[model samples]
Target chain A: MFVILVYDTAAERNPTVLMTCRRYLHRTQRSVFQGELTAAQYRELTSALSTAIDPEYDSIVTYTARSPGMIDSTTIGVHLGGPGDIL
Target chain B: MFVILVYDTAAERNPTVLMTCRRYLHRTQRSVFQGELTAAQYRELTSALSTAIDPEYDSIVTYTARSPGMIDSTTIGVHLGGPGDIL
Candidate 1:
């Protein structure tokens, strides 16, 4: 599944959550990551995230695109690293 | 269609692009916006974005979710505005 993961954690745990996500996905911007993953990888990611966040505090939203090119994206300003980075 | 729009514009035009997007979608973060847009709305947004950005420089990527709930999302930090807001 291709996913766009957006997260917001307490200030103290920001690094931990950010690092964990960076290990699995591309850090497009602060608290935002996106890339492809298999069901297993997704499960693993969710598991790690669940432990990193407090249910009553932090929030993470993941959008799973239906297909590879299903996402119609546009670029406006400076180019940061993106899907083009990998294959 | 449901879409997640991410953009990275030049430092100078950032505000213009951000405000344009905010008019059509929710500002999930600094440059990330997501919401449901009709085909017409999507076209309009693209048109506006194209005019707002310099293709040679800026980049905007729009991910259209297959279905309303097809996107399985999770929240971790502070819940800014979301799908639950208007609908």
Candidate 2:
């Protein structure tokens, strides 16, 4: 499946959250990550994030599609990084 | 179509971007927003955001699906506000 993960966490927990996500997805831009993941990997990613963040202030969301092509994404602005660069 | 928009912008421009998105979508978290939009509304949103952000440092991304169910979403931690609460 293709998943896009977006997160906003407390300043002190940002590093941990960022690092955990980078381990599984491409850092398309600050606070945004996306890539393909198997069911197990997807479960693992969310679990790691749940453990890294403070439930009171941090929020993380994942949007999944059956495949990358199923999602219509548009980016307006300079490219930072991510799977979007592939032609 | 159902659209999910996420943005990371320079501090000073955050308010403008946030307000613009709020007019068209539900604020799902600090940096994420999602709602259903007509093609005209989607175009207007991208245009508004493009004018509000500094391309060199800010990025705005939109993900669209045929229907809300086409994209499976999972949220961890507190949701600031959004359409997610509906039964």
lDDT of 1 by residue, B1-87 (tens): 887887767799898988788788887654567888898998899899989898887777777755567676555556666755432
**TM-score per candidate:** 0.71, 0.91
Docking class of 2: medium
lDDT of 1 by residue, A1-87 (tens): 887887767799888888778777886655567888998998888889889888777778787765557665544455566755442
Considering just the first chain, candidate 2 attains a TM-score of: 0.91
Docking quality (DockQ) of candidate 2: 0.77
lDDT of candidate model 2 versus the reference: 0.87
lDDT of 2 by residue, A15-81 (tens): 8998888788987768889999999999999999999999888899899998988888888887778
The residue pairs in collision within model 2 are none
Candidate 1's docking class is acceptable
lDDT of 1: 0.74
Q: Which stretches of candidate 2 lie over 4 Å from their true place?
A: A84-87, B84-87
User: Weakest 10 consecutive residues, lDDT, candidate 2 chain B?
Assistant: B78-87
List ranges where model 1 is wrong by over 4 Å. Answer: A54-57, A83-87, B7-18, B27-31, B50-59, B84-87
